[model samples]
Structure formats: structure tokens, C-alpha cells
Target: MQALTWWRNPGTKDLDAIVCDGSVRAGKTVIMSLSYVLWSMTDFDAQQFGLAGKTIGSLRRNVIRPLKIMLHSRGFHVKDHRSDNMLEVSKRGKVNYYFLFGGKDEGSQDLVQGLTAAGFFFDEVALMPESFVKQATARVSVEGGKLWFNCNPAGPYHWFKLEWIDKLKEKRALRIHFTMQDNPSLSPSTIARYERLYSGVFYKRFILGLWVLADGVVYDNWAAETMTTHIDDVSGYESYYVSCDYGTRNPTVFLLWGRKDKVWYCLREFYYSGRESSNNWDDSQYVTAMGKFVGTIKASIIVDPSAASFITALRKAGYQVIAADNDVINGIREVQNAMNNGKIMFADDLKHMFAEFSSYIWDDKAADKGIDKVVKDHDHVMDALRYFVFMVIYKQRTATTAKKPVWLR
Candidate 1:
């Protein structure tokens, strides 16, 4: 409430911006977005403004939909020009225009280059590149223009943390830190459910709302004894999948997965290290081995995106191959979440995968540079596991869970 009236309040009138950073489901996004709209409508007239998220689709789903409802209930007229990605809002003869933007990558700066905005609201600003933020902020040139930022915390050395957050006084920005406790809408059970969704670095960032390092093992939830399933004890397979990490000079690994109910079992593994072998297998030879490994089992094969030749060989051999979604960080998080939720279990006989799991650790050097990376060593099987869980299982689950609004339907 205070943040919404900050500009009007004599004590905080001099502040130039507002930043809300905190835990997930903590009310930062809702409150900050609402405040931005209210502040813009109250203070400005017939002006251009900007509202952005990591992607236009996300911005609409997270901010625009709920915002439209709130405004309508408040007796304001809202016209969405979907084709133009703009909103025409008015109340009591007062009007304003809000343009939408997606700050998804380094090239996103081009999207906001020509706009002259009275203010800009960035949701999940930490996910956007520094270049996009700089370009977006530069467009807010109108007098009394302000910036509004809301995001879950990232690394300790993230640009926003180093600049806007650490130098809050210098930037004259009001920083509001939030936790799940601040969101009255979330019941205790809901908050607890969200808390169980993350562990290790993610837990610290999304649950505790801390800007800390992602150090130690990447999968703190992994345990060979508890996470592995005996093949003889499982049955009733619904489908099967083969996830591959193809390498010529390095190591090539293929993990065979089978699903039963909500749980996916890593049934078997085929690991070959070319460096350790006297001969490096060609694409055809690798395909032959994969055929033998997957004999008579109809399964979708997911392979590393870089293995073009290998993928062609598989396809030529009458096998269906899918290029894995190779987003390392997101993949790792999904895999970790699967483990935390008991969605995945490995066969006890898969010795090589268990070995790789125990040895896979976060790259401290990368963390020190404010980057999240796992050590490349001992990760072939782990990569294959990540590919299957993230692309096939996690994506399907996410799509299934995201309910579209009634109007959109």
C-alpha cells in the first residue's frame, strides 16, 4: 500500500523507482504490477507506458489477464489491442496506453528502441539480459517517469543486485523485500507445497528469498539407495523413451526410460567412452549399438542437439529421434524437482549412472563469476537423464498444469 502511494507521499516523493524482489508466490508480482498500473493511471494522462516480462506470452498470462479483471472491477474500461500488443485504458475521462514487451534475450533491446515511455514495469527482471534493461530504462524519459521492477532473486553477483539493489540509496529506488508470509492469498498448505518444490540453491533463492551462490552438488536430493528402483519390482509400462548424450572423442551415454503411473524409471543404460576404447565408433556403429540396446522396444529417442550426424544415422535406421531441449540450468532444475517429487527413479543395475550422479558437482569457478554451471566431467549419463526428464516429462506436466483463461478458450 505504501509503495503504491510512494510517489504521492511527501516523504518518498523524491524516489525515482520501486523494486520488489523476493520468494516465489510471495505477492511481489501481483502487488508490483497493480501498483505500477495504479500509479500510472493516477499520476499520468494520455501517456505511453511499458510493461514487460521474460516473454510476451508470459507477460500476458502473469500480468495482463489478472490486471484486466482488477481494472474492470474498479469501473475502468480496458481495451486490449492484441495485434498491436497495446492496452487502451480509461476511467473518468482519463486515459493511458500501455505497451507490452518481451525482454527474452540480448537482442530484445531492439524491441524497445524507438519507444518513449512515461514509465516501465519489468516482471522477472532478473531473467532479462542487462542490455535489455538498459535499453528499456533509457526509454523512460518523460518527466516524473519512474521504473518498477519485480523478480525472484538470482545469483549474488547478478547485475540488478550489484547495481539497483546494492546502490538503492544512490539510485533513489524503494526496495521492498517479500516472502510467502506477505501474501495473504496463499494458504499455509499452498505455501508448504511451494516450499517442497525447491531444494539447495533454488530453495535459497525462491523459498528463502536470498541472493546466494549455487554451490556444492547440483542435485542435493539425489540418493542412490532411495532413488533407485529394482527392475524386477516394477511393471505395467505405459511408454518407453531413450535419452542420449552422444559424443565421439568424449563419452557417449544412452539412458532407457519407462513410465508407470506418474513415475518414470530409468530401466537401463549404455555407456561407451571413445577416449578409453582403442577405436572410436562411427555414427552407424553407434546406431547399431542403440538398436541392440533397445531391441523390440518401441520408444521415442531424444538426443543431444549437437549430435547431428548421430541423429541422422538413427533416423536412417528407422528410429524416431527428437532433439532434446538443451537448456542446462532449467533442465537441471526440472531434474532436481523430479527427484524431489519422487517422479523419477533409476534401476539399481545402472551402475554407471549412479556413479555419474554421485560425482556431478556445480562448477565453483562459474559460480564465482555469477554463472550457474555443472562440472563437465562425469556428466554424460546425467545429461541423458536431464534430457528425458526435462523435455519429455517436465514439459508435458507443465503444459498439462497451465490452465488457460476462459476468455482465451
Candidate 2:
């Protein structure tokens, strides 16, 4: 019944799958695992179920073991859930469950080597490589079988998330999101701990399930094509604007957004890893780099609220900076509008951004309450981009840029 709430009012629709990211207290993993089973039930399949994670040990302990206790306690007839590193459920002697383990280990690929699957779980998804997940999914021969992944946002860089979650987002892949508040059973202490541990973008992504941009974010949607190495100049029919996802120790992210006809395009991004060369040197160097990259594209440069310091420095350094409005949901609304309207595109250099677009998701707990983009971890670039788009690019301060009222993506 609860899963239906999220399914009915998800942030992004057309989902064949979902991703639930939440704080430690949030039952993201539990919700996803149950959703896997719930979705499986709606599909009306008693076929074998599989669960795997970063290692055989983890799979056994985390996925298989706990799931067993959960099912058993819930009156589920789990015929066999053992530390033998296997889990199985049965109704009337028909085996319906089989939990297993896997990872980047070459041998992990062999776990699925010979078996046909109805569906499977890939836990700790952020830790696994994209190659490993791909190989495992390919091995699923059960028609219409789903491959589900659950993980907390772990790093500024990860390949699987970039490809599956991030890329699919731009192309508009099916997905769902969640956060700790979604689960009513969590203790307050856990929530408080997570709140204390993360802040700003990090907190938003992991705890809130917001799809903001991170330092490693790569996508310049304003480019001629999503991923072109071509040096040809791209023309546009609309004005241009820039959105910056500010970071200090992390890489500073800059995206140059442009509007053409009715679409929003990200032409290029300026991402810097190393520290500024001179202490006196304002970050304008990045802005300068972005200026050269965009050339004469006449558009205002919009930045996130976090960039207040950066913007101040830029202004002191004599650079023009237009701060992005950064209205959480409103920004996401604009991006969704551009995407659903088929008016968004990416530049070649924006690969990372593209990846984030696909991989980013919402916090399901928030979705259940009809709150979209609840700031789960893993997809910050997407969040930052949304702010840049709606709050700044899509809105004309001179004219009201009204968007759809609150709705889950």
C-alpha cells in the first residue's frame, strides 16, 4: 500500500525501475527491497528472486540475512534464507526466492553465470563498477525481469551511477527516489546524525534526495549534441545564461545554459580540480575560462546561492555574476518542462552532466508525501542544473515564469 503511494506520485514517471536514497534512518534499502517484491507481486510473478551486493559476505549478511528476518517476521514463508549465502522463499512448495552475492570480482560475474532470473537486487550500487552491473544485468534471462539497485551516495565520482542513473536521466530513463523521512519507523537520532554529517548539496542529495550537481558533474547540454568531440561552433535561437554549482575543496562546477526556440541547452561546462594558482587570484579564472569557451554567446551568468562567496569574489574582481534563483522544486520543474517538451540538448564536453542526468533520482519518502526531489545522495549535478534552469534561465524576472504546481516528478 505504501509503495503504491510512491509509485502513483513519483517525481519522474515512465519508470521501469526506481532508486531509493536516504539518510541512515531512512529505510531506503528496505523500501527498495520491498518495492522490488511489491513490483514483483503486481507483475504477479512467483519466479525466483535474487539479491547481491559488493561482496559475497555483504550479500549474505546485508541483503540475504536481514531480508530473511524481515520476511519471516512479516509472516512470509521464506523456505530457506541461510548464511550459505543463498535465500529462497516458497509458497506451497514453489520456490520464489533466491538471494545471492556479487561484486566487481571477476568471479562475481559467475554467480549469474548459469541461472535464469525473474529479478535481482544490486545493493551498495555506488560501490560497484558500471561494467560489473552491466554484466550482471545482461545475465538476467527472465523476460521482463527487473534489475534493482540501492545505495547511499558515497563519492564525488563513480562510473555505474554516471552511466545508468545519470545518463538515463537526460535521455529520460525510468526512475524513483526516496529519503529517510519516507520511512515512519526510523528513530530521531539517526535522522539527526545524518543532518549533522552532511550539509548543503551533500545533505540535499543523500538526506533530501535532491538531484543537485557535484564537482565531478559533466554535461554541457548547450552543446550541439549530447556527446560530441567536434569543435564546430553551435548556434542558437535564444539567449544564454550560466549556472555555477559552487565548491571549495571540491571541483568548482560551471555550466553555460542557453535557450533556443523553446528548448534549454547546456553548451559547455568548466570543471576545475586543482586549487587556484595564486591566493590573490579570484576564481574568475574559471569564469574567464568559461567566457572563452562560450565566446560571444550573449547571456547572463547565473549562479547558485552557495556561490555567494564566489559571486562576491567575482564581483570584487570586476566580473558580472547573476545569481540563480535556486528555488528547489521550481528549478527542477523547468528542467522537466524542457525535457518533456523535447527542448533540451547537451554539448560534447558535458558527459559527466549527462551521466548525472540519467542517474539522479528523488527520495521516495518525500514522493509519498507528494514532495518531489527530496535530496537523496548521488545526483547533485542534476539538482544544481535544475536550479540554474528554472530559478534563473527559465524565469524572466521581468516576467513571471510560472510552472506547474507541486507534483512528484
Candidate 3:
């Protein structure tokens, strides 16, 4: 396992220095120092070394201890660190280096001040203030010593993030996102402990190596006002078909779409339900309410095949009701086809549907990386949309009715 860790990152030539990028137990500090002793020795000139973290305590623990072990194993000799907690490394005859300093100290730049370093490493970079990190980077006057920055992504705006990731715009620093699984040495129990302790956004970000946004926002691309075209008058909508995902406990949702002037416009949506008692309407009432909605809009309806009961209720109200063929996988294919062809259109008011549209991910299960929807709650509006597409387009059989549901809708 250690051999694999050693092999995973064979040092690059440009790495007059290299920064190890990984999560907490990813052996970053171990890998960095190993690369340093093995790779940096060949480079000529004075070697200045720096190590720091957000606090003196972390400097003593996470960074220094592991680094010292790696250096010793790799045969680099270290002078005794002073009472002031500074040390240096040497190889046989010609070596220049200084040891750990505390980034945890808010006033740490003074300690790093005026030093020409072969390289400098900033561990747990998110915890350091932006200014202190900037000052440290500025201090590396050595002609080619690499500046080291490594950390689990914390708040996205950390200096390492702003400069190297977000703002550098160019790939100046080699960055990697590593997970606990990458380490391979940790016991299953240890991994489980971390998993049990961390969940939601935190667990995914730190443990699973996902670059996810907090607050559980499934769709970042959803735009109500821009992605949609609004229409107030219903005159030109022509005949309409409504498609629904009927649920008594969850929100009952329906998409109202139609063909007009040879264009598909999804201009409206119906969404509501019975709550625990008062706020949400019940199943029968919800179906009747949908009947009233269909009457008001005066549209023909096709519903999810799974909701046979709802179709019965709609038909009993003297409305033309048909079962929507649900080919979830194919429905997704049709939707993708329309979007790729620039035929899909939405209206400003259908915010929930827009949310589903933005969040509907491809089921790339073979990747086994959990990139698609497995929880299913976020796909409610999408199921309604799939029915809309199944009924409107991708029907396979042409209807005798004149504008046989334009597949683009």
C-alpha cells in the first residue's frame, strides 16, 4: 500500500518542488517530504524549507511528525530543532534547509520574513488568513523552489482557492482532489468512523472528494426568468395536453404544454398538495382540483401510466384522458435530443420544472461514482416532464389528430 502511495505520484520534472494534494488521511505530508528528499537533492543551490499551519499545535502534530518520519526513512539527516522549535535537514555534505514554523500564529510572516527558501509548504491551507499566506509566498526568493499549498477544500474562498483555483484562471499550481479511499492503509473501522461523523455536504466534500455546494441546492443552472418564455393570453395555445406525476403525500405536479404556430411552448405548471392536515389538499381533492385546472385551461390530458387511478378520475369528469407511456430511460433520451437540437423551451413561471431540468443528471451508473440521482426526491418535477415528453414527442406511433403531439414539446 505504501508502495502504491509512493508510485501514485512520481515526481514531475517541473516540480523543482511539488505540493501533495489530498484529504486528511491521504498521506499528503508523507508524500510531500518523500518527494522532497528524493527529488530536491539533485537541484543545486541553497535549499530553504518552510512548514506551517493555522496553529502551532497543528504544526507540531499533523505536518511535522509525519514529515520527520518520512525524512528519516528516506535517509535525510536532521539537526536537533531548537527550543524555539526550528530545525534543518542535510545530506552528507551540501544541504541547506530550515524546519517547521507556525502558520497558526496570526503574526507568522515575521518568522518567515526575509528567508530564501528552496521550497515552502502550507498545510491545511484553508485555515490560514489570506494575508498571511500571501506574505509567505512572497518570501520564497529562491530562484526555483516551488511554493507548496495543500488542503482539503473548506470554504471555497480560501486564498489557495482564490489564487490557484478560482482566480489564477490558469493552472499555475498542480491541484488534486483526494479522498480517504485513496489512502488505502486506513482500517475499515476508521473509514466508517469518519463516514458516520460526517454527512451531507461536509462528508462528500472531505471524504468522498466531491466539489459540492453547501445548502443542498441540487440545481445551480436553473434560471426561471431566462430559460423560460412567458405568455399571458391563452388564445393561441391551441389544443393542450397535461402530463402529471400524481402523489398524495408529495406535491402533485402537472406540466401544461401545447403546440402553437408550429412551436412548442411549455408555459405553465400545476403544483400543490395536502399537508399533514391543513395546508396540503388530499388525494381525491387534488385529483378533482386537477380536473378543474384541466377545465379552466380546457386541455386534453395524458398522465403517467403508473397513476391509473388519477386517469380514471380525470376521464370520469368528461375529459379526454389517456395513459402516458413511461419510458423513463427513453424519455430522458428524447429530452436530451430536444435540448441538443435547440427545440426545448420553457416559461418563466415554471420554476420547479426548471429546477428539475437543471438537476436531471445522466445515470452514469457504470462509473460507480454516484454522479446521478439515487435518492429520487429531486426528480419529481423531472418525472412530470418525462411524461410530458413521452406524450408530446417520442410517441413512436402517429396520432390521427392533426398536430400529433410535436415531439419537441
| CA shift of 269, model 3, Å | 47
TM-scores for all candidates: the values are 0.95, 0.45, 0.47
Q: Order the numbered candidates by TM-score, best leading.
A: 1, 3, 2
Every candidate's lDDT: 0.89, 0.59, 0.61
Models ranked on lDDT: 1, 3, 2
Which has the greatest lDDT? 1
Candidate 1 on 122-221: residue-level lDDT in tens?
9999999999999999999999999999999988888889989999999999888899999989999999988888999999999999999988888887
Model 3: what TM-score? Answer: 0.47
After the best TM-score superposition of candidate 2, give how far the Cα of residue 245 lies from its true spot, in angstroms.
Answer: 36
Where does candidate 3 stray beyond 4 Å? 1-12, 15-22, 44-46, 167-171, 211-213, 216-409
Q: State the lDDT of candidate 2 residue by residue for 1-409, as single tens digits.
A: 3444444445633444555544445565666676666555545445766677887766654555556566666566664444555555544334465657678555566666666677777887766666666667776667667667777654333454556667665534454456676778767886675565444445556677654444321222222333234324566546776677766644566777766676666677766545553233346766566667667666556666777777787677455777777666446545654543355666666766756655555554554433344445444566557767676536654256343223200
Prediction-by-prediction clash tally: 0, 62, 10
Using lDDT as the measure, name the better of candidate 2 and candidate 3: 3
Candidate 1 vs 2: which has more lDDT: 1
